[model samples]
Target: MTRDKILVVGANGELGQALLRELGTEKAIAATRTANTPHVGFDHVRIGSDGNLPVATLKRCAAVINAAGSVAGDDQTLRSANIHLPRVIALAAKNAGVPRLIQVSSFSILGAAEYIDRTTKERPINAYGRSKAAAERLLLESSSDELSVECVRLPFLFSATKPGLLAPLLSLTTRLRYLPTVAGNPVRRSMVVYADAAKQLVAAAQSGLSGISFVADPRPFDYALLATILAEEADINIRILQVPRPIAASIDHLLPALGRRLLRSSLLDPCANRVGDEPLGLEEELRKLVRSTYGS
Candidate 1:
């Protein structure tokens, strides 16, 4: 229980686990819903949903990163994860003498938009979005010098975990060698891979970054570029099929009800340089992913 530790909530999650690895066991103590032995080199503390995070768990922590959140579930579940949990964590962190709390939020807070800039505000078009936005508002209202709070709007991530959009897109590369370059697809959008996003979270927690900000890869990509990287790297053409931009975009429209939205080439902006000077390394990262996941 060193006083310099960081308590990472939801340490079992994709981003949370990455953060734990990035921060290392020496500085990180995992705070999870239930005690478990999954993470080998670190420590774990129970953070129950009772809105009562054990103060002792955070006592030694200089900061807390709320990687715990829900994107899909019933109304109660969403509200609990996105809203209640965050508010509770903030209170616990402040009380425990933790100096900073970095909350994990989603870009869904900006619901339907083709292009977004600094001027865009939260106009959530869905329940999940609304829930996340509400959580953010709660944190902002409570922020103070004693326990500075910051919410990071993490976008659809691309990683080996195959986060929502990447799962389908990466599926296409396992079996296809020849991919098409489409009109809408030079679509550089606001998205980042998991490891990069985790690093940004670490930076935010360490700096006690103020206000709400967005995170994304410094580089941009679309169907052809991503697909080529996978096919060339994996050398195994087995499982995914990428459609052209117009076709993919149309599919996105046709299934608005689908929980996982397809990656539309619509220009999604994550606010430039919000992630500082980290190189996105999209090509190399994807190549490694292909080898690890689909390569022989």
Candidate 2:
């Protein structure tokens, strides 16, 4: 009997690569815009310039996991990748009779919600968030008896292979004697290790549930605690300085570009809190991240 093929779009991306590693090469096919990518030794499909999945390729797969996304891009680029591409894929999957379509979405759509669940209303504050929210809406709305569509919303992800948002924090802790933070050290936002998140995405695809599902680490650490954990693990000491939120917000407003960058860093102020299965705790996650970046 032939094993069902799983086509992973944006297979070269961090989440896409994680899925490839989790699903293994035998059952997975990598789809990207360009054939030349770091992910080698796997079957690859090239996405067309028109942003449509090839029908022939779609028919050969059991399911299509769209991990394609962009955190940094202009409005047009964001919409094309985050919104248009997913819609195109959904339509193609339905037409090809693909049984399952899992879209990897982000927590950015939650905006400043303190707690997020399956029923939380999305309030996107920026172009990236807006695009993702729109994509999720489009895909979920398009689901029918013939096609199974679901969106797995993920929080900040870190892993040995992908440092993600941790890279900047690691740099700051090691380089700076003092790290500035909001006046009140806010609780750390929700996050999941890459491997765990990858497994969750695969599980969501296999499950029969439809609509939005969130995946995150069970326990979240605040900024100071996270820095302390990293510092201890790395054998480096750094001081934490608290700055007023209004002042920070003012600075951000004054320098719009810089503020946007900082907000993405998750260093500004905690907006939404994430809740999910925590296979690995904060310390363990930070330890793995530090080992990957600094070497034990």
* CA-lDDT, candidates in order: 0.74, 0.75
Q: Model 1, which residues run further than 4 Å from truth?
A: 161-163, 172-185, 234-253, 257-263, 266-271, 292-296
Q: What TM-score number comes out for model 1?
A: 0.84
Candidate 1, residues 1-296: lDDT per residue as tens digits? 56788889889888888899899988899888876934898988888758567787788888999998887899999999889988888988888889999999888888766466656778888889999999988999999999898888877776754646555556654445443333443444567788888888999999957788878776655655665665577554432244566676565678754313444443445444476545585656666666767653
lDDT of 1 at 230: 55
Clashes of 2: 1
Model 2 is weakest, by summed lDDT over 10 consecutive residues, at 266-275
Clashing pairs in 1: 171-240, 172-240, 172-241, 174-238, 175-237, 175-238
Best by TM-score: 1
On residues 1-296, what C-alpha lDDT tens digit does candidate 2 reach at each position? Answer: 23388889998887888899988878788899986754677778898897777777788788899999788889999998999999998888898889899999888897755566556677887899899999988999999888888888887777756776568766765787666666764444667777777877888777787877777766664556656766777666677767688877886789865454333233212232223343455557777777667676
Question: Which stretch of 10 consecutive residues in model 1 shows the poorest summed lDDT?
Answer: 257-266
